[model samples]
Target: MALSVGDATLAALAGVAIRRKPARSGAVHRTGAPVLRDSVEAGTFEEAFFAVPAKGETDRLLHVARKTLDAARRLRRDARLGAKILTTSERVIARLTGSAVRVYEEILTLARLNRGRVFPSYDYLADATGLGRATIGRALAILEAIGFLVRQRRFNRVAGQGPGPRYEQTSNAYRPLLPERVLSYLPRWLRPAPLPEDEVQRYADREADTRYMLKSLSCRELAEATVSGSLGKILAKLGAAVDRREREAQIDPQPLTDSYNKAQTVLA
Candidate 1:
């Protein structure tokens, strides 16, 4: 987390020269504008776009961070980066190994403070992540393949010619590509998040199980419940109506002999 000149390589430590003081953790005082969390009432979200009480500078900066984190979360979830890398998999593998992603984010954390630039050498990455040189190399490769990171080359300096170094090679430069910004390279239409065949079948099975659960739990009274509070009364009335309708039905095929004789005598 701190800078060590002797240990780092020129290519990877490009973003390390700058340092920012941590945000002071204390009670924030309210100032100019009210946040939306403070204003949400029953009526409408459109009218009252109030925000949470940002008491001080700390809270305000935190508010900004929360917004950024939320945006990053959305971009991460909806992105089909795994599928993009493994073309044969074609399905969105939302949950992949985080080793590479973690490294990518560590670079982003530095880049965010450094104004969208990160050039950590593999050594710095290894030191920060506690991973081996080869592992870090693989992680960086994966990140580049998935379009979450990019790099630039800086001209190596010759000691005699211009700068302090004796002989210089091109040092690596890096940029962390955010999810939302990735659309520039990987279009939305091209990045379709599909489910694998097995996953799709499992989801279908789950749906069927849920439907059965609902059917087993369902009742005629509940179905007949038209209003909210008076369900019992409604059910009682429905039961009575059903009984009466059954009594009114005349299903007999023939009249009794006594009734027939009475009818004949009355006609006579």
Candidate 2:
């Protein structure tokens, strides 16, 4: 993720900005002594504080900054997947098409770096994502509708006072919304139950037939094959269509359950 010119300027400003540390407890005590003694004590304190660094504080802050940056980057990546475009509305599994997802991800990356300030222009997005201008526009529209972003009109004074809009991420609520995980699974409400071993074998066979039928078979043949499969096998096949759904359901459900249980305990 290369920083934009605006973002680079902001970063430079933040880097040089000095924040005042709170007054130390012994400042008065040290200053109250003889001037020579105070000077000697100040030098000693400076030597102790700056000369020999506390490895633990330095290491901890570094770790935290690294983690925060990583998390921010991941959130930006996932925000694109959250846009919810380019898939069939039907329950059948389908991969997302086009570079819209990539564009959305880049938008998120820019937003993260700029503290939610994303330039919403099609050209900006297309340039960042290498997507076509039209594709970027479509993706931006979809993203705006999904509540992940908000568009605000601003006057571009540099361009002689015409109104231009900027896109900003409204949902700074970070979660582990990985794009690979999102695209690979169905929603929890639509997910099917796990199949038994016998049903799994039957479903595997049916899946093979489904793939074959997908390659120009007649509608009647495909219908007949679908109908002839056992109910359990059909369900299992559907479940397998989005392999990560079960895992996501499992992973997502427990924390919620635990939270409910804890609340109930408090009430009781």
Candidate 3:
């Protein structure tokens, strides 16, 4: 499936631009650092510590998140707009220093390892990225501000007896997001291909029929009569086809070679 971007208001965009400044020198990269392992220690997170979404949904979101960051890296390489004023989304991309990227990459690695269930604590992130907790926090804030990800705060429920505190904070559940404004930075070939004219018209007709059905049919009638035979079969087949395509997309994802030229040639 193609990536979906979240809507951003103009005011929100302006706020993002005003709040952040680019990082100057990149942080030190630790060489030969010990590989981070999950532990039962205070800082290490357990599976119960998180409230993650379904794997398939998270996987799709993660793919978009990766592409968005890739676009940011590409922009930094091509433009080299150092110290110049930038738009909201551009600034968000520009501010991703080496340290921030490292932190993000480590998070991605962990997410992949856990099969898209990501809820790493600050301690884990810092240890993995070889940066301090403060640096990890800042990087996460920036990533959140850019609409590249979301953090859901989770809390531990109190044990059997009544205690002083009902719930205590645990590791935040992280999910990736894609903001609409940053879509321009994505490579042309990576963008979703437009539907052919016939397919577009078919969908338009289906939408019109749907609207008519909503207006004309009662809820029970619609559920029982309208949803039988050809219409139901078509809907079921459509859903199955989408699921199949998504599975196929997961296998291939992005081809290195640009197929846009070939597509244009065929069209011509």
Candidate 4:
């Protein structure tokens, strides 16, 4: 079976190769036409090397790869991809020194490229990134604690059969979180607005003033108050409407008002 150009592109974008299993590796996986030969003497079926993807599987893989690339590209072009978030995040991250930044950069790369799902072992990352495993651990810890990243430890329940104890350690997935809840983590300049130091006192004072005004003022006066609170705004609208009607009455007296007075006299 020939590999398509789209499949090749997906393989490159995924940073992983999809190749035909070696002739002697183990049991072969079968898709429609038995791409893999079931070996009688081999280990469990799961241990079989994944054979080259069938046409349908390859099509699906390519579709997913294209979609992921499109999503990543769209994210880059987002209108909110402004300097403010980057500036704020950098100011906060500047406190850290050393390999943490390198590890973080690598994690960010993986997360952005894979849509927040990175599944590379420590050794793979170390080799690909040229950073010590211990440094990676420290960086991940700091990022996770600071809410800049989320780490999920995955355990490889099934181990591949090898000469030694099947090394069953799975890589941790690192997801980089966007600049959410920036106020707590960023500096005052980066935040939209800082709460006043006497915020609680100010709230108390406002509450007291609101209660006193509500108790002392008539509905019309309350509505017409200078303060722009929700209650005052509503009342002001009602008062304005009533005042407009009264002024119109003073201009030329309502015919309905005179008619009602005449009716009352007839009733009496």
Using lDDT as the measure, which candidate wins?
A: 3
CA lDDT of every candidate:
0.49, 0.43, 0.61, 0.52
Models sorted by TM-score, best on top: 3, 1, 4, 2
Give the per-residue lDDT of model 2 (tens digit) for 143-187: 444332444322211222334522211212111112222322334
Backbone clashes, each candidate: 16, 0, 0, 3
Q: How many clashing pairs does model 2 include?
A: 0
lDDT digits (tens) for residues 1-268 of candidate 4: 5779999889889988676443333544332112222212112121222122233432332233233334334434442565233444444443343455556666655655654456577787788678888876776775565455555543333434544322232455555543343334334433335478699789999999989878887557766555343445777878878877877789988698889999999999
Using TM-score, give the best candidate's number: 3
- TM-score, predicted candidate 1 vs. hidden true structure: 0.32
Q: How many Å off is the CA of 7 in candidate 3?
A: 54
Q: Model 4 off-target regions past 4 Å?
A: 1-95, 159-167, 179-268
TM-score against truth, every candidate = 0.32, 0.25, 0.44, 0.31
C-alpha positional error of residue 7 in candidate 4 after TM-score superposition, expressed in Å: 55
Residue-by-residue lDDT tens digits, candidate 3, 31-111: 211212221222334344444445554454455556766766766765675535466667677665566656666666666
Better of 3 and 4 by lDDT: 3
Q: Per-residue lDDT for 256 in model 3?
A: 44
